[model samples]
Target: MARSIKNPKKAKRKNKESKKKGEASSSSSSVPSMPAKVWQPGVDKLEEDEELQCDPSAYNSLHAFHIGWPCLSFDIVRDQLGLIRTEFPHTVYCVAGTQAENASWNYIGMYKLSKISGKRRELVPNKSNGNESEADSDGSSSDEDEDAQDDAQPPVLQLRKVSHQGCVNRIRSMPQSPHICASWADTGHVQVWDFSSHLNALAEMDAEVNTGATNSFSMDPIIKFGGHKDEGFAIDWSPLVPGRLLSGDCKNSIHLWEPLSSGTWKVDATPFLGHKLSVEDLQWSPTEADVFASCSADGTIAIWDTRLQRTPAASIEAHKADVNVISWNRLASCMIASGSDDGTFSIHDLRLLKGDSRVAHFEYHKQPITSVEWSPHETSTLAVSSADNQLTIWDLSLERDEEEEAEFRARLKEQANAPEDLPPQLLFVHQGQKDLKELHWHAQIPGMLLSTAADGFNVLMPSNIENTLPSENP
Candidate 1:
């Protein structure tokens, strides 16, 4: 949302009253009260009297659900709606693998969430006749609100689960065929499975059907490969080449999977060995069919081309600590984003990789970054989740505007106070989740994001940022 001040005079008055009271208390007590400031996770330790506060107005819509066990990885399945959808009241399909306490209790869950709707609240209160008006009572409505009514029914979730052999380390959906997905097992095996049956079952369960009752399905992986020497987390499907796949392991081996006419995959026996450490993540180029990228524990990013020999076409020292994840921008093909174990993430322009390619860098997250993804709709936007229990959205195009900052502080100093060191590019910070592991932008819904944490999952769209999604109108 465009920067604006909320309320200045009222906040100043309240602050003055509190300061007076604090001064009176200091005369008798030795302990001094901590001044009010925007709480920064990880950087600021919580006191016994402190508790996290959530602002309901910051989100247009939010929902949280659990499927019994924690899932370390998940993928959003593409729907019939073509990519670049900006419509509201959306429906989504997703598949996730569980990290259960008992390996036998682990399952692969397929989900269908429908009637996902909520009204977008205005970030700035409407001013009329020198009085502030609430967003909900302003009596102004738009088409977006028509689709997302204020009293819209809560989103419905229908789930279908299938038993898996071991804990799934990572999972990815095929870009061309969302129902056909692959998973990396902690048991040192990569398996491909067709979940079309589970999809069909979920699709048949409409609103009238009872979704609270869990349904279990029996199935086996369509194909399994146990060539990797150890368990790994890196896996991705090529967007340019349908059914083409890549998998890397803890033992520093990467395999190329080529689709065959027989419906199975032909993985290269001779692996691509470039990294000196475990491959942590992999991403196929959005524009190139033969080219892909990988990040490793060795703190390097390797660009590999299957057409060439098993060596990396180019390798860059991306981070000081282990490079944990990477995302190739689909709209901006030349730009790539990466997150690292040192709690920092950076954006690099591939065209200048040989020179000074890092265009932007952020050290906001105070813990190891868990996931990073560029928005499918906004070229300059991206989302990141960290072990610090925070998911932050950023817009790289923004820079510090001293004039705007001054106006905001002058008018809304007490309403929405922020640390002076807060980055201007930081759009929103979402918390409340414990041990966030992975997140994905819904391919079919503009601005919608689904994240999986140790507790469960959260589906949300921030009110301040999501309204900026590209529209046909100006």
Candidate 2:
């Protein structure tokens, strides 16, 4: 949850009163009071009705409908938002709002597969030999006849929602429900909207609001957090863990919350602290519920095991500037990747220990690396976005074989000596008009990459079929 600090004047007033509470309390209790009266019939009934109307179910029904995909047209983009799958080859991408002297609403969009047409194909089931002859005699098709009628269809892409209040900086999907936690700059609040049941489901008309009025169920978030003295920059949900959330603020603090039986949420503990600068991102460990990672402007990344509160399980001072993002390798629990403002990206292996020491370092970048992500379906591949206006995919599997490294280096040298015969680096760059703010690979699809840039453009780069990138091979 996001919140602001109390005003200093108000805090001082309370502090002053507390210091003289004994002297002030006795005299303050003698204030006059009004006598109570019996309630009026009509007036009391109306007030009771108003109170009942404030209930969540009475106020509105949560409905999700498909909004057309957003058009990418913005200038001076500041961030990117995306959803992807590690097992499938698809991605949904959104560009952050832009402010190029004038303010216009920014939008989110999904990538389109060029070669695949947006068409629905009918499915027909096959018949086996036992029922084939009998079914055919009664005008019912045999399994073979049914099988011949089935056709493979490309997946249909749908636009989910459009933000009217501008671009969304951060978004997270809930594990237990089809809900999303979205943080917006316009309101400086995080909204939780139910969207799970809407996926692949048909849309329906929104229920009435005022009875005399027709109301469309707006994506007015069910719960709003923040809008206090501080604004939120990052938000995340515990994967597969219900009702657990974490959000980071500019004051360099992390807030944790859990749901209560009353249907409202409350703080679970004191804010987690360690970073001296604002935290840029937070990620829960893929394998462990109690473990997580946080990167900060203080040029460090710390791994936290919630079970041990005294200190981080591991801290790496691998960057010279703020660590913008950190991603855990879902396929390999012991591996993690981080991108930083110092124009470098680093991958660390927790399993490799050298006589009680750990190996943690970085590979340099030409510009500030704003985002980093490990392939959810592939163990050895990682992706990073940078201010250099390019996104690069890394093959960490290359590090495992000395012969492959030597061969790559030899190819590089040969390329330098002969301009035309050199082998290409596995790293591919997706060019943008401005600095890339963020990059994400699909959670289910291994190769599809989604990127947002400073110029207010979101692009989806599908995995090339010619690129025989290994899933676990890197």
* Clashing pairs for predicted structure model 1, backbone only: none
lDDT of 2 by residue, 1-474 (tens): 211110000000111222232332111334432211212211223232121111111000111112232222211111122332222223232222322221334333222221121111112224457745532342242222223322323333333333335445566555454334444343455555544333322122221111111122235555666633355556677774666677777677777666667654665446678888887788887678887888888987777777777366777675778888888777777877777777777777766522322244444356777778776556766777777665666555533344544453453341112122111223343443365676666453334555655544333332221122334522
For this target, which candidate reaches the highest lDDT against the unseen true structure?
Answer: 1
lDDT of 1 by residue, 1-474 (tens): 344322110111112333443232111234543444456665666665554444444556778888778999999998885665545567788999999888888889988888777664443444655454343243345334534544587788888899887899999999899899999999999999999988887877875443753555678888999999999999999998889999999999999999999999999999999999999999999888899999999998999888999999999889999999999999888888999999999998899977877888899888999999998878888999999888988888777788887766654343445567767888788888899999998866677889999999999887666544443211
Model 1 lDDT on a 0 to 1 scale: 0.80
Global local distance difference test of model 2: 0.47
Question: Count of backbone clashes for each model?
Answer: 0, 20
